[model samples]
Target: MKETVKTKRRSFKHLVPPVDLTGRIERSTRMDRTIHAVAKAVRRRLGPGRLRDLLHGVPTGKPLHPPLVTVSLGCWVATAVLDLTHADPRAARAVLTTGIATALPAAAAGITDWSSLHREQQRVGFVHAVANLTAVGLYAGSLALRLAGDDRRGRLLSFAALGAAGLGGQLGGHLAYRQAAGANHAESVAHLVPLGWHDLCELKDLPDGRPVARRLGYIDLFVLRVGEGVTVLADGCSHLAGPLHQGRLVSEDGSACVVCPWHGSTFRLSDGTVAHGPATAPQPSFETRIRRDGVLQVRPAPL
Candidate 1:
């Protein structure tokens, strides 16, 4: 007697990503570490003050990367339009020159932002930097050739540069929108929660020296009680939205502070001031009170 055997094939949809994709991620991760180390060394050599301010956009409400990228990429777009139409070489050259000038500041701002990101985000950012650098090289070559009166070669190089820039722009969008790398993590908490006092918990439920998590609607809050007074802040860290309740509580300059578990950015619990950074913005602090029912309450601080 003979026995029959049967096997069912797996669906293509159930298959995992190819091994090469995993290899690419690993390689990018290694490069991310190397880039970060090099950047740190360069920063140490430069020291601090104006250079740091320029990189972090200390004078601006947000990270400088977005505006710098917009200006440089906008110039490139104008040049690309001119190239496609075979417009005047002088006009194209002027646009390309402006783009090149803005590119340096954009790269500096991007590097500054990238250095503070987590490992996974850093992996994406590293590939982004490489793509941008390649584009820069192509554009620089194109500019040199154009200046030398070799319009044919210069135009071809500009097309290649545009392709590289498109790839880098895609990665940059993923970093900003998907990864939330440079977002103001606590901004939403300001609007979503009700304006008046919302009861958090009973005074007895809170621990004396520890932070407790409380949720109201879409907002998560970190509540800390010290004797009769309570401090309430948005649970998300402004840097990367790290859970503040999980962070260690410490005193900085005689004020109670919470250190973000992700990036070590510290915030004063009382006023939401940035005591330390990587975080350019402050945490969202709340006004707290003991309600008539003896329940703890919190409201968004006055603007």
Candidate 2:
């Protein structure tokens, strides 16, 4: 007797294209090439280690991009409102000028976040930067025209610039909220971890005053051996997941703290407390204990 067999075909339902924006968000290859060259030159001038730290915001345990972008957005909105309503010209000019002035610093913060991002994120960020820069130029021209007795022309130009800035802001929002670029991608790891200590590795494997990387199922932990005991923390830096295990262990008032190699965000080895700003969220700490067989074990702390 012949046996009947059935085969199932796989579907491509999950391969849907991303929602397209009203306007093209694609970056020019030539522009990207130029930016890459410039980034490399800047990196060389700053030195790899310093540049990496500057962009990483390790000290704050969070990426500086969001705040900077938010501030820029606020300035743009305020300036636009003032220009439209003919509200205090001095204040409008001040806000617009401040926004333009702050762009460089904000760009610095963004670059720090960008350094640790994936290739796709980097590409999106570069495009976002170009768009904002163009908007800034337009706004500057508008300001000049306004001061030169061309109020109507100035207002029109300002409105146009505001429109461009808004588009740039939307793209940035997409990069952050939608794409999760410059975000702590490993945040869900805490939820996945079990509530009890699990054998990680031998205690001796972790050197004194050094950060060691260990795995707890899907979660990566940065383990530090300070004194008689070991402390375990999320291995990925809260700022940009910059690999805290590569950071330096420093003593702050006789307490052990790990300094992130990326941006210098320091965390107490005992408990994940923000020793500094930038990183608003505390690093998720783990309950650490030694097993009977002299193995170091760790688990998620009680909520």
Candidate 3:
């Protein structure tokens, strides 16, 4: 006769308490999905072509949201401090008004950037937006109370608004630093690829009128050939790290361009200028030439 023992299989679910944790997780996941879907719809209606570019600071070559947020939040913080310290009421009123006004554009820019992010990043951004909206409401209430000559309630509301704003600022920092929502996706390509010309491929290997992906050291390069000339740009789109090599080549406004596969950010081939975007930064372009040996070589262009 043999004795046999049965053992239970291990599962991570076992570590979870016997509470309603599953239900809570399901609800949170559903909300996140809803938020992501709503952001996608808003982005489509807003159009990521030109208007989004303006919001993203493509013309200025940096994210506009950061500076705008700094000013907006700075004013609110100053107002809160002034109120707490029994400083000039007129100055506090002025700052609160300015903060409210500045927050409008800052929120707009933030939403524009938020719309282009992936689902995980969008979830964080959604909470961030909600917090800021709450702060704005509190500040508005404070302003109205101040106008009604209720200094005590106004100061209290301002304090609450400051707390909400601080929470929102913390989330914004997470989005920028942890999730990299507004950072350049292809910034590393410049540093990774050597400055000198590196042989890409033979001229015949790259067909004319097609966007081909090539590797130069650790960087992926998008190569396009157009009638006796070759154009090379970083393959990673600046917005959300979309693959430009898989994008369509189109002539927009008489300039050769490539549109991002993920977000449709269009970049000019000649100089890597942003043609249309949710992408704030331009793609890094490389200078290309065909040597007598029929080898195509590319090098980082001067900034």
All candidates: TM-score: 0.78, 0.68, 0.88
What lDDT does the true structure give each of the candidates? 0.83, 0.72, 0.85
Could you give the candidate ranking by lDDT, starting with the highest?
A: 3, 1, 2
Q: Which ten-residue region of model 2 has the weakest summed lDDT? A: 22-31
Total backbone clashes of model 3? 0
- In angstroms, how far off is 290's CA in candidate 3? 1.4
Q: Give the TM-score of candidate 2.
A: 0.68
- Quote the lDDT for 142 in model 1: 98
The alpha-carbon root-mean-square deviation between model 2 and the true structure, to one decimal in Å, is 8.0
Tell me how far the alpha carbon of residue 281 in candidate 3 is from the true structure, in angstroms, after superposition: 1.0
Q: In TM-score terms, which candidate is top?
A: 3
| Model 2 Cα lDDT, one tens digit per residue, 40-107 | 66555555354455455555656656677677678878988998788978888788778877777787
Instruction: List model 1 lDDT by residue over 1-303, tens digit each.
Output: 898788897789657555544236534655755877866775575444456556766555467888999888998989999989999999999999999999998998888777768777778888888899999899999999999999999999999999999989978887888778888888888779879888888998899978888887798888888898888889988888899999988888899899888767778887988766667788988998887888988889986
Candidate 1 residue spans exceeding 4 A from truth: 1-54, 187-192, 204-219, 246-257, 273-276
Which residue pairs come into collision in candidate 3?
none
Kindly give the stretch of ten consecutive residues in candidate 1 with the minimal lDDT sum.
18-27
